[model samples]
Target chain A: MSRSSRTFRGTYFSCMSVQSVSRILAVAFCLVSACTPQQEPDQEPQVRILELQVPANFPEPEKVMAGYPLSEEGVELGRKLFYDTRLSGSNTISCASCHQQQLAFTDGVALNKGAAGTPLLRHSPGLANLAWMNGTFWDGGAKNLESQAFGPITAPDEMNQNLQELVSELTAVPDYVASFRLIFQDEIKPAYIARALAQFQRTLISANSRYDKYVRQEPGGKMSELELKGLTLVQQKCGSCHAGDLFTDNGYHNNGLDSDFSNHSYEGIFQGRYRITHHPADVGKFKTPTLRNVLVTAPYMHDGRFATLEEVLRHYSQGIRASPTVAAAVMQGAEGVAGIPLSVEEKQAIIAFLETLTDYEFIQNEKFSSPFN
Target chain B: MYRIRRSGFYVAMLAILFLAACKEEKEGPAATTSVTVSFQHVVGSEPLQLDEVIYTSPAGDSYAVSNFKYFVSNVKLISSAGEQIYVEPESYHLIAQDGKTSFELKEVPAGTYQRLELSLGIDEELNHRIDHLGDLDPSNEMVWDWDTGYKFLTLVGTYTGQTRSGGLVFHIGGDTNYRTLALELPQPLNPRQDGSSQVLLQANVNELFQGPNLIDFDVMNSSGHGSGPSLIAENYTSGFITVLEAK
Candidate 1:
C-alpha cells in the first residue's frame, strides 16, 4: 500500500484524464449500488420506555448524560443494590443502612457507624432533591452521586468493599446479573454500579412538602399565621446561605463550627469547599445541608453538631464564631446583628414554618424503598 | 455464563478475521504510534526521594517528601503541519510517588510532532463527570473524596515548620478559580520505526518554595483542600512541568 501510494503521490493528484474521471464516476456509482442493503427481516433493538420526571419546580438535569439516562430498570436495579448488603465488605451494611428511607434517608444519629460498627466522622446525610444538588456529601466531595457511591462503598470505615470484587460478587448473583443486563447491556463493572446507584438516587425527589404545596397554592398546603410570619423571616434572615427553593445556596461556608483550621487530612476537619479547591480560606467550611427535610433529618450540621432546630436557631442567634473564613452572610442577619435574634415566639413560629418543608410522601415513597424487602 | 462464552467466541472469530485482513492489505502500522511518557519527580539534579531529607528549597525550608502525586491528562500532539492528535477518554492519568508515572499514548499518529500539549491535572469535563473509571478510579488516592474535583497535584512532606503532625500537605487542583495547569512544551520528536518512543518529562518540586512566588513555611507550613493565599499553589502551578526529552 505504501509503495503504490509513494509512486503516485507527487503527480497523480495534479492531473486527471477524462476517461479516468468517467471510470472513477462509474466505479463510485457501482460501489454505491453494491453497498445498498437489501430490505431483509430485521430484529430492532428494544427501546425500554423510561418514566423519569424531573419533578415540579426542579430544574431539568443538566442533560441526561449519554448512554446512562434515568430509566426504570436502572433505578430498580439501583434500589436493589442500595439495600443489598453484599455491596459492603462485611456484607452487613448498605446505603440504606445509614441513609434509611424512614428517617427521610438520614441515619438519625450524630455520627452513624459503618460496617464493623466503626464510627463515621460526619452524620449520615438525608438524601432528597439530590437531583438538583450539584455536589454530594457533607464536605461536598465525590462530585456527584455516581462518584459519591464509590466513597462509602470503598471507605475503610464505611461499607468497605473492593469495587472489582464487588462486581465479581454481583456477577455471581443471577438476579443482579440479570438486572444489570436489563439496564446496561454491558457487564457489571464499577461504572454500571455507580450509574445504577446514581440513577436511583436522582429519583429520590422530595418536592411534595407542605411548603411546596403552599407555594404552589394547592389545597391542604395553607400555612398558619405564625408559619407565614416565619416564612417572611426566613426570606429576610436565612435566605442568603440557605437561599433558593432547594433551601441551599449549594456552596461551601465556614459556619463557625470550629475556630482552628487544623485537620487530620485534606477532606477531614470537614475542610468543606477548601478540600475540593485546595484553597486555604475554605478551612472549617462545609456544604450547607439542604433544609428540605430539616424537621425529619434531625441531628443537623455537617458534623451533626446541632441536635434540634431550636439548637440550630439558637446557634444562628449567636451567629457564627469568629473565624477567618466565616461566611460573610453568617456574620449578620436581617437585624444586621452578629446573630439572627429571634424572640421565643418568633423561634417557635419559624420552627413551625420549617416543619412545613417536610414531606411525608417523600420518606414513605414506595419507589425509593428497598426492592429486597 | 453461556452469554459470556458465546460473546468471547464471537470476539475471537472477529479478531482472527481482522488479523487476516490486516496482513493481506494493511500497511505502515495504521499511521499511529504508541508513546510512553515518564515523569521523573525531581529536586535539584537527582530524582526526588520520598520520606528522606535529601532536598532543600532555595528559601532554606528543609523538606523531604512523604507523598507526592499529580494528574497529567488531556494530552494532545500538534505537528508542524498543524495536525492535532488527541489521547482521548483515557487521557487522564495519575503520576503518584512510588506509583506509576509512565503514561501511554496508545494511538498518537506516527509522525513528526513539534509541540506536545498537556494538562498537569484532570480536565474539567472528566473531573466533573462523576461516573469515570480506570485512572480516575476512586481507589487511586488522586480524588478529593469530599469535593467534586480531583486534587490536580498533591505534595506531602515532613518540613521544617509543619504544625500538623501529618506534615506539610500541598494539594492543588480545582476547576473554578484554582484552575488546572495546561502545560504546552515545545517537544520535537520522531517515533522509532517500531512505532514506539519514550518521552522524558521532569517535575521539579523545589520550584514550589524557590521561585518568584516563594512559600514562607516558617509562618505557614501547611495547606489542605481549603482556600487561602498559597504561594506554593501559585509557584507550583506553572513551575513543575518540563519536558526533558521527546525522543
Candidate 2:
C-alpha cells in the first residue's frame, strides 16, 4: 500500500477504538447513576424534634442547651441507652431501674440498693433539674452529670457492667448501632454515649413550678403570704451560698451533720473537695446541692440521715457539728462550735419556701419520659 | 497532513499551559521562620538555687528554702519586627528549687523581641474550667480546688520569730475583694536572629511581705493559714516585679 493509504487506515482504526471506549465509558456512567439512590424532590428534610419546653425566665434555650445540644436522633439514642437493661451485666437493671419515673426519678429507698442488693453509701438523688446542677450525687462527688453517669454503671455494687462490654452490647443492637453511627458520625466511643445521656438529661429543664410562675408574674402562680415570708428567711440565711435561680452556689460547705459518724470521722465521707484535691483543709467538705426539688428529694445530706425535710431544717437549726473546716461565716457565734439556731416557726417557713421550688410540669413532661412507649 | 500537524500543535499548547500553571504555585510567598524563647527564674540577682537561705516573710522570719515551686504561664513575645508570638495555651513551667527554671517557647519567628508578657499563674478562664489539663497541669496546682479559682501565688515555708508562724502555706488566687492580683512588666528584650532569647525573672519572696503591714508569718501559719487577710491580691499587685533587671 502507499504511505498515505497505510496512514489513513491506521487513523481510521484508532478513531474507531477511541469511539468504542468512549461509548463504553458513557454506558458505565449511566448505569452507575441509575443504580445510586435518588432523593425524592417532595421529601422533607430529616429534622430532629426536641419536645422539651423551656421556661420564660430560664435564659435563652439555645444558650442553656449549649453545654448539651439535643437532637431527635441523640435524644432517641439516649433514651434507648437509658432504659436498656442490657447495659448492666445481669441485663436486669437499667438507669430507670433506680431512677424511676413514678417516684420523681429517685429510687424510693432511703439509700439506693445496688445490683447485688447492696445498700449504697449515699441516697439516690432525684434527677429532675440536673441541667442546672453544678455537681452530681448527694456528697457532690461527681462534678458533672457526664461524670456522674459512669459511677452507677461501673460500680461493683451498682449496675456492675464494664464500659467495653456495654459498648459491645450496644453495637450488637443494629438499631442502636445505626443510631449511634448517625449521631456520632463514626466516633461511637463510650464517652459519646455518656455525652448523649448528659445531653438528654440537660433537656430535663424544670421551670414550671408554682414559685417559677409566681416569679414570672403568671396567674395562679402567686405565692401565699406564708411562702413569701419563708422565702425572705431563705434569702437572709441560706441565699448566700445557695444563690440565684439555681438554688445551690455550687460550693462545698460543712453543714455539720455530726462531728462523728458511727466510728468514722466526719471528714472521711465529707470527701467534699478532698477526693479531688487530696488536701487536709478540704476535710468534711461536700458540694451544696440545688434545692429546686428538695421537697420531693427527701432524706437529705450526703448520708441521707434526715428522712424528713423537718429534720433537715432542725439539723441546720441545732445539729451542726463544729470542725476546723466549718465555714467561718457559719461559725460566727456559739464559741465556734454551733449550727445556726432557727426557731420552730423559722424551720416551718423555710420548708414552705422550699416547696415552692418544686415544678410539677417537670415531673409530668412527656418529652423527658421513656420514648420506648 | 495539515490536519495532523494541527492536532500536534494543539497538544503542544495544552502542555505549555499546564507548565505555566505549575510555575505560579512553585514561586509562592516566602516561608515563615520560628524562634524559641527561654525563661530563667532568678531570685535576688542570681539564679534561684536549691537549699538557698531566703527570708520567709517580712516579719524577719528566716528559713532555708527546702521546697519552692511557682507557675509561669500565658507567655507572649513581642518581636522587634513587630510580629507577636503567643505561647501555646496552658503552657505551665514550674520554677522548682531543683534548678529547672528554664522554659522554651517554640515556633517564634526569627527576629529581635522587644517585650515579654507572662502571667505568674494561670488565667481566670483556665483556672475555673474543671478537669481541664489534669494534675500537674499548671492550672490544677495554681487553682484552689475548693474555692473554684486559681491560686496566683503559693508560698510555703518554715519561720522562727515572734511574728513568725510555724509552717506557713500561703495559697492565694481569688478575684474576691481581697484575693486576686494582676501585674504587668514593661521589659525591653532584644531577641537575636535565631529567634531565641533568655529573659531573667527575679521573685523576691521576702518582698512579698515587706509592706508597712507586712504579712505576719506566725499569724499566717496559725489560725489564718488558709483564711483571713486575703493578702495574695495586695502582695502580687504591690511587689510582683520588685526587681526586673534583665540578665
Candidate 3:
C-alpha cells in the first residue's frame, strides 16, 4: 500500500475533494435532476457493537453499560492507550505502570511513585469489576471511571501530562488519529481518551477465583476445611463492609486506621471521604475494596500500611485505633473493645480463605496484557 | 452499529413526512433568525483591563485581575406572547476575558422577546460527567478532575488587602452553586427573519466581592473548592450581570 493510503491524512485529502465535487454536482443536479432535501454530511464509519456480559456468579454491575456504549474497536484502542507511556508528561509512565495485569492491576507497593518521582499520597488499588463500583479512589471523589482516569493522568504528582499537549501528541500518530476518529467520530480530545480508558478498565473482570468457583459449584471448586471455616469467619466478621459475592459493599467506612485527621496536607488526603463530602461523620472514611486477588495485590488499605494479610487481620483483630468515626460493626466488639476479636488460628484460617479469593486465571489472562508486549 | 442511509427516494419521502408532522404543531412563521448575546466585562463603571488595571472591591481591597472566565448556558428567550425559544444543540458557552466575548443563539423564531433567562453555570446533568466536547471540554481547565465537576466561574488575580496580600482566586462551582440569571431587557428585541439582533449584557467584576456576603480578601483570598463557592454564588443575585440594551 502507498504511504498516503496508510494514514488518515490521505482520507482527509480525499474528503476535501469529495466535498468540492458534491458542491458542484449539487448545483448542477438542482438545475437538471430532483435533489433530496436530506443532506448526508459524510459517509458513516463502521463500528461493531460489543455486549459486556456479567458473570452469573457476580451481581449486576451498579452502572451496567450506560453512557458511551462499548465497541470492539474502542476497547482495543483503549487497551493500547492504557499501556502507552505517551500519556505521561515525560512519556515514561502509563496507567499500566501502577496497574499491572500480572499483579491483578495493583503495583504491589506501599506507595507507588509518580512519573515525577514523587511519592503518591495513596496506594494504587487493584482495577477489577470496576463497572460494579459507583465511585473511584479512596475518598470516592471521582464520580465514574471516565472521570477517575483524569485525576492520575493530569495530576502533577502522577502523570503530569498537560491534556492539550497529550491530544497534540496523540494526533501526531496516524494509528491513534485513525482509531480515535473511528471510535469517537471526533478529533482526539481528553474526554474521548478517558472514555476509551474506562471502557478497557471495565473489561478487567476478575471473577474466576477458587472462591467464586466454590460459590458457583464449578470444576476445581473444593476448599479445605480450614478455608471453609475462614470463609465462615469472614462472613461473620468482615462481611458487613466487604459484603457480598463481589467482596465489597462499595461503601465508605472509617476502619479505624488513624485517630487524628489533622493532616490537611495535599488538600486533606488523610481525611478520606470527608475531603469530598465535608460531612463530619465521614472523616477518615475510605471506599471498601474488592478482596479478589488479595494474595497478589499486597500492601493493603488505602495507604498500603499493612504488607501482609496477617497484618491486615491483626489490625482488624487488635490494632484498630480508636476514632470518632469508627464503623459501628467494628465497635460492636466484646465490652467496648473495638474490632472483631479473632484468635491466631482464626486469622490463619481467614488468610487461607483469602488465598482462595485469588484468581490466577485473571493474572495470567493474555487478553488484558499489554499490546506492546 | 453504523446507520446505513436509505436510498434517495426513500429519504426524500421520509423528509416530507417529517416536515409535515412538524408543521402541524407549529403556528409561528416558518422562517428563523439568530440572536447574538455579547458580554462586556467591567469593574463598576470602568472597562475591565486584564492584568493592567487595578480595581478596588467593596471590602476596600485593591486587586489586579489577570484572568476572568465563566460559563453561560441553557439560554432561553421569553417572547412577548409568552412563547419560549430555547437555544439547542450547543447552548453552553465559555466566555473568557481574553477569548470570544459573544455567542449567537441560532435558529431562533423571528419574534419580539422581552426577557432573557440563562444559567450562569452548567446544569447538574451535564456538569457532573465532564465528558462533553466544546465549551464543556475538560481540556479548558474549567473542570475539577478529582471532584468530577466544572468550575462555573474562575476569577484569578493578585490582591492587596489591609492585613494579608497575595494571589486572589475565586473559583466557584458545584451543583448547589449553579445560579440562573433572569434579565428584563431594556427594550423589546425584534429579530426579523434572515437577520439578527444583539443583546448587550454587562458583567460587573466588583460585584463578586460586593454582595450580601462581602468577601474580604484578607479572610478568604483563595477559596471555591469547598464551602466558599456557594457564598460567592449568592453574589449573582445582587446585580452581577444586567442586560444593558436589546437592539
Candidate 4:
C-alpha cells in the first residue's frame, strides 16, 4: 500500500498542476499517508538502496547488482564482516588478512599465510572490479562472490572456520544480531553472511586510475610517449585474454605456465582450470586476472612465481613452455620461439603503462579501510 | 428519477456479485492437502545402521557406511491422466542418514496420483546459488565450498578391498551428475482434504554399488569430480529408491 501510494505521488508530482483536483487529492492523501522518505519497493522493505556509480568510460556490467542489491545497511554490515576476525575459526584471520586495501586488496607476498600459518597454494589476487567477474578464484571454481566467501572461510589452512560455529559467534554479538535482523530480516545464517560480504566486495569498483581517466578524456589523463606505446603493445599482445576496459575477458586460458599436468596434489592445484572442468584441454588454464593495479599486486601468476613485471614479460616473450593446452595467442613468435617477441624497451614501456593503472584514491580511500582501525 | 434508479440497479448488481464471490471463496472445489514422504534407508535387506553394519558390495568390498546423505528435489506427483503436480516453493530436501529423513510437501490438490518423479540433486538453476536457507544451506557441510555446488550425495565410510583398504568418500556432485528417478506408487494415492497421505520410500544402499554401473571401491574409492561421480550417479537412476507404499 505504501509503495503504490509513493508511485502515485511521483506521478502526481511529475505532471499534476498545483490547481488541479488530482494535485489537491494527492496533497490530501500525502498528508494522511505520512509522506516520509521511503525505500525502493523491494521485497526487503527496510533496505536503503546504495547506487554504485559506473564510470562514464566503463561499460555497465549486465548483472552488477542482481539477487543481492547493494543496500546502505547491507554494505556497512558487509564491511564489518569483511574485517571481522570472528568469521575465522581462530578469531585471528579475516578476509582483510590476505586482501588488504593499500596493495589494491592483495597482501604484499608471493604466498600469504593462512589462519593456521600454512602458506596458501595460490597468490592472493587483488580484489577490484569484481562486480563484472563471471567467476571467482584463479581457476574460476567458485561461480560468484556469494559462493566464493565460503571457500577461504571454511578452508582448513585459511580461516578454518566451522560455518555453524561462525553463525553462533556472530549471533552472540548483540551488534551483529541487531544489524543482521535490520538488514536481512531473518536469522543470521551463512547465506545472509555471504550476501552481506558480497555486497561490500561488489562496491570495490576501481575505475579512477590514470588509464581510466585517459580513456574518459578527463583531467590528469596526460600520458607520456612510452606509456602510449605500451598501451598499443598491450592492446596488440595481451588483449586476447586481458581484453576490454575491465582489463580481463573473464575467461580461463592456459598461458603456457607449465608443460606437464599429471600432478594431482592439493586437489589438482597445479592442473589449473582443468581441476574445475575436468577437461584435458583446460589443463594449466586459469582465469585471466585483471592488470589493474598490476604495479602493486606482486608476485604475479597463479602460483606467484614471478616477483616482478619484467619476469612476467620475459615469461610471455621466452619463458612460455610449450604445452598442448597453451593458448594459441601466446604462440605469436617466429617458428621455433614459443611466445610473443617483445624487446626490452617494449617491456619497460608496458610496465610504465601498467603503473598508471594504480588508483591512489582507491588505495587511500577511508571508506574501504578497516573500520576497527 | 430514471438516472437514480439506474445507479441503484448497478449498486444492487455489484452487491450480488460480491456475495457470489464470497460464496465461491467459502465453497470452492480447489482444496489442498499435504503429503509426507518418509525414507527408510537400507543395506540390501537389512536396515542401515551407521558406523556398525558392514555390508559387502556386489564387487565384494566390505564397507561400513559412517555417513550417508543425499539431496532429493523437484518432487512431482504424476496423475493417471499424465498430468504432473509439482511441489512448489520449497521442494529441495537434503535427507541425511543421521538427521532429518522425512519432509512434507504441502498444498497438494486432491487427486489420484500414480507415480512420483524426483531428482537426486539440486537443479542447475538452484545449485549455483549458495544463498539458500534450510537443508540447502551451505553450512550443513553438504556443499562443496571450493567448487561452489551442492554435493548431491555423499557416502563416507571405510572400505577394505583386494586393491585398497582406506576411506571411501563417494562425494558425488556436479551439474552433469544430476539424475532423475521415476517410481510407480504401490497403489493410487488419493490425499483427502484432511492432509493424511504418506508416501513411504525405501533407499537401498546396495543399489549405489550395483544397478546399471557396478562401482568397485578398489578403483572408484573417492570422487568429487571426474568420471567417477557420473558413474555413481547413474546407479541411482534404476534401483536406488522404490515407493514402498502410498496411503
Candidate 5:
C-alpha cells in the first residue's frame, strides 16, 4: 500500500520509510483515487465517557478529608474494582455483592449476609454522597474516607479478602493492570485502590431528588399536601440534627437505642462509639446518618433492628432507651430521659416527607453502575 | 565527515544555550524585603498568664482559664502602597494552653505593611465546603469531631464548686456566634533589606470573658455537654473586638 493509504488505517504507520514505497505505485494510487468519486470522511460515533458531571455549585474537593478529586481514570478503575468478585475469598462477592445500584446502592435485605453467611452486625448504609459525611461506618469509627473503604474488604465475616491478596489479584488482570497503570501511574497498591474507590464514591451525588426540586422551585416541582405536612413535622423535630441539603449535621449522638446493656452478650459487638473512644459515657453513641434516600435503604438504625420506617418512627416516638450519653435534647425530665411524641398520622407524614428525598435519577445513572459490561 | 561533525557541535551548543535559558526562567526573582507579624494576647498592658484571674462573672463565681483556643482565619497583610497580600488558606493559628505567641507569616512579598486584618473562626464558605475540622486544621485543637464546626473560642476551666474531674470543656463554634476582628497597626516600619522583620501584636484573654455581656463561669461550667445560645452569645459579645497594638 502507498504511504498515505497506510496512514488512512487507524494505526500509526511510522515504521514505513519513504524508500519502502514505490514511486510508480504511489502515483498510480493517487491518480486512481482522484478519478474515483469522493467519499465522506469516516467519523467514529462518540462514546459517552462521563456519566456524571461535577455540578457548578458543588464545592471543590477539599484535601483527603472532603474526598480525593474524582477523575475519569480513577472512577473507571473503581467501577472495575467494585464489581470484581475476586475481591471476596470465594471469588463471588464484591462491593456490589452488598451495594447493588438498582436498590439504590443497598442490598435489598433486612440484614446483609456476610462471606461466612452470618448476618452482618449493622444495616449497610447506602454509598450515596458519602464524601460529605464527617465520619464513616454506622457508629462513626472510621476517621476518613480512605479508612472507611477498607472495613468490608478485610472483615473476616464480610468479603474476607486480604488487602495484599486483593491487590495481587487485581494486578494479574491485564486490563486492570493497564487501567491501574493509567489511573494511579504506578503498580497497584491498597491505598491507591481505596483512594480510587473513594473518588468514585464521592461522585455519587444524589441532589436531584423531589425534595431538591421543590427547594429549587423548578417547574412542576412542588410537594404534595401530605408531603408538605410531613416536611413541617421533619422541620420541627428532625431538622435540628438532620439539617440542610446534605441531610445530616454530621454529629454523633446517643439516640437511646437500648438503655439496658446488662444483657452483656451484645455489649462488645454493639457498643458503638464507646468501642473507639473507650469512654463509658460514649457507650451507645453513634453518628447520625444522613436521611437522604431513607425510603430505599431499609432495615434502619446502626443495628438494622428496625425493619421499616414505621418501626423507626415508633422508636423515635416511644422506644427511647435512657443512657448517660443520650442527647440532652431528647432528655426531658431530671432523670434525663425523653422520646418524641409523634402521633400515627404524623409518623406517616414524616415518612412521606423522607420518601421525597429519594433521587430516582441517581439510582439509575449508568455512570455509577458496574463497568464489567 | 567534517560537515557532520560541525553540525553536531552546533546542536550541542544550542542545547547548552536552551538549558541556560530554561534555568534563568525557572529561578525568577528573589524577594527584596520581608516582615513577620506576631499576635500576642495581652490584658491591661500585660501578657495574660494561663492561671491568672482576668475577669469575674456576674454570679460571684471565681474564674480561671485552664485552656483557651480559638481560630484566626482569612488573614491579610496590607502594604503601605495599598497593595493587599492574601494569606494562604489553612494559614490559621490556635492560641493553645502551651504558650506559643508567634506564628511565622510565609510567602509574604517584601514591602512596608500598613495593617493586618483577620476573620475570627472560619468564613461561611469554608465552613460549609470542608468536611472535617473545616477551617480549624493543624493550627488549632478547636476541632470537636463529635460536632460539625470549629469551636471559635474555647475557654475551659474549673469553677469553685465543680463536681467533675476536668471541671468543664467550654467549646464554642457554629456560624451564629463567630466574630471577625479587624485592626490597623502602626504604619510600615522600614522593611528589612534582608527580608526579615518582626511586627508584634497582643490579645487579652481577660477581655474575652468581660464587657457588656458577663458570662456566669459557674453556670457555664455546669451547663454540661454541647453548646448553649446564652454561652455562645456571651462569647460573641465579649471577644468580638480584639484590640491590636504595635510593640
Candidate 6:
C-alpha cells in the first residue's frame, strides 16, 4: 500500500515526515507479521483538575483553611463562577473583568473603573498563590478569601452586585443550577458562592518561575551573570521585605512613598494597614505584595504610582521621601538617608533579576483561564 | 433467653403504641404563634410616596427620594415580666421604601408582652461574617459594597445642589462609625396559644432630619466614602423608629 494510504490500528497515515513514515512502517510491518490492535490514548479534559503543586525545594505552602477543602467539583464550579458576570450588579462585569489571566490576572492599567464607572482609588493587583496570604486587599481589610470575594462584587464603585439575590439569580441558569447541585447537592447559597470562589482562587498557584526553576536546578533555569549579581544585591537589600520563595515577607511597611499626607485628596490618600490595624503607627503601611510576576504586574505600589520596574527600582534607590512611619530599613542609608543607594548598572542588574521571576507557565495555564473565554 | 426476648418485644411494642397515641393526639409541631411586623413608612405625618418631589429636608434642601432601604436584624420580644424571647438566626430584615411590607416571625411564643425591640442594622461582630446569612446576603440590595462593610441604611435621591453637586447618595455603613442601633418601643401584645398577631412599625422619614443629629441634605447630600455618613446615620438611629402600632 502507498505510505499516504496506509492505516494501522484504526489510525490514518500521512507521510509528512520521514520519522512519522518510519513509525507507520514499523507499525504496519509489525501488523503484517502478527499483532493485536493498539488502543487510543484516553481523552482528557481541555483543562484538568489542578492541585497546588509545590516545588521540591520550596517550603510547604499554607494549608487551605479548614471547612474550605479544595474539591475538583468545587474548583470547576468556582472557575466558571469566577468569569460569570452575574456577580456584578450591572451583570456586565465579573471578577474576571478586572482580573484577566493574560496580564498575570491584572487588567494592565493603573486603575480600572468600577461597575458604576467610579474610578477606583487603588490599582487591582494580579492574583497568584493567594492561599498563602494571611490577609486580602491592599489595605488587608478583608479577613479571608470569603470576605475578599464580596468586596468587588458588592462594592458600589465596582460590580455593585447584591449578594443576597445572587443565589437566586445563579439558580435561574439551568446549567449553573445543575453544576451547583452536582457539587453542593443542596440549594445554592452565598456561603457556597464564596466557598466555590475561594476554592478556585486557591488553585491559582504560580511556582514555575525561572527563579523557582533555578532554585530547583532545572535546565533553562540558569541565571545569567548579571542576574546572579542582581540576586546577590536583592538578598542584601530587598530580601528583608520581599523574602522567601513567594517573594513576600507578608508584613506591612511604609516604603517612603509620601512625605506630607495633605498632598493627597480627601479620602483619596489610602491609609493602608492603619485601616485594618487601627494603629497610629501604621499610618501609611501597606502589605508587602508577592513579586512572583513582577515583570507583568506593572504600575506598582498600593495606589499604582510607579508605572515601571525602573521607576520602582528608582524609588528604592533614591526616590523615597521622608515619612514618620516609614520603615527604618527604607530610611537606612549612609547618613540615615530617605532611600537606598543604587548605581545605574546595579539598577539594570536588579531589573534583569526581577524579570527572571516571571513564570510563563503559570500565566499561560489554561486551567486558570476563563472557561467562558 | 426466650423469656427476655418476649419481655423486650413487649417493651418495644408498648413504646411504639405510646408514640403512635401521642402522634394521633398532637396536631403538628409545637403550637406557636407568628407575629407579623408591618413597616409603615411616612414623610412627616403622611404616608410616604416615593419619587414624589414634595419632601423638604430641615436644611432647606428640596429633595425627592428614589430609594430608601435599611437593614433590621436581631429582633427580640420582652414580656411584662421582663422575660426575653429572641428570634432565631437574628431575624434579619430589609425594610425598603418601595414594595416592602411586614416581616413575619413564624415561631414567636404566645404571650402578653409590653416591650418589643429590634436592631436598626446588623450587629458588628456578626457583620464581618457576611457570606450567605439569609437576608444579610451581599446580593441583597441592602449591602453597602464589600470592602468597607454592609450599609445599615441607604437614602439615595436627588437634592438641591447647594451642599454638594449631582445626585444625592448616602450609603451609611461601617462598624465604628454607625453600628446597629437597637430600638426599644412600648408594645402591648396579646397573642393566642395557636394564633397570629400583628405589629405595625411606623418609620417616619421626616424624623431622619429632625433628630439630635440634624441632617442637612445639601451639606451632607452624599456620604458613602468617609465619616460624613455617620453624622446623618447617627440622627437616623433615633429618628427612624417613630412608632410601634401593635394589633
Can you write out model 2's per-residue Cα lDDT over A93-207, one digit (the tens) per residue?
9898877665567766677777878787776766765666666655555556555666677667889887668878877888777776666554345556676777677776767
Candidate 4 has which clashing residue pairs, if any?
Answer: none
lDDT over C-alpha atoms for residue B15 of model 1: 64
Q: Can you write out model 6's per-residue Cα lDDT over A1-373, one digit (the tens) per residue?
A: 4211111222122213668868767755654433334544563222234467767866676765433456787898899999998988878998988898877888878889988787798889789888788677876777667667877877778888776567778989898777666665557777678878988988898888888889888887989999989888888788888888878877888898876554334343477676555576877888898878888898899888888999998888788887889988787688888878888998888889988989999889999988886
Q: For model 1 chain A, where is the 10-residue window of minimal lDDT?
A: A2-11
Q: In model 2, which runs have C-alpha deviations exceeding 4 angstroms? A: A1-54, A58-68, A138-141, A260-270, A328-337, B1-247
Name the top lDDT candidate: 4
Q: Score chain B of each candidate by TM-score.
A: 0.78, 0.63, 0.86, 0.87, 0.66, 0.80
Q: Which ten residues in a row have the lowest lDDT in candidate 5 chain B?
A: B130-139
Please state the CAPRI-style docking class of candidate 1.
incorrect
DockQ per model, Cα? 0.20, 0.02, 0.29, 0.29, 0.01, 0.12
How well docked is model 4, in DockQ terms?
A: 0.29
Q: Which stretches of candidate 1 lie over 4 Å from their true place?
A: A1-51, A57-67, A115-118, A217-219, A222-233, A240-245, A252-285, A317-335, B1-70, B80-90, B94-111, B151-247
Looking at model 2 chain A, which ten-residue stretch has the lowest summed lDDT?
A2-11
TM-score for candidate 5: 0.52
* Tens digit per residue, CA lDDT, model 1, B157-202: 7766434233677777666424345444456677664646877888
User: In model 5, which regions exceed 4 Å deviation?
Assistant: A1-68, A262-268, A332-337, B1-247
Per-prediction backbone clash count: 16, 9, 0, 0, 7, 11
Order of the predicted models by TM-score, top scorer first: 3, 4, 6, 1, 2, 5
Winner on TM-score between 2 and 6 is: 6
lDDT of each: 0.72, 0.60, 0.84, 0.85, 0.64, 0.73
TM-score of 2: 0.53
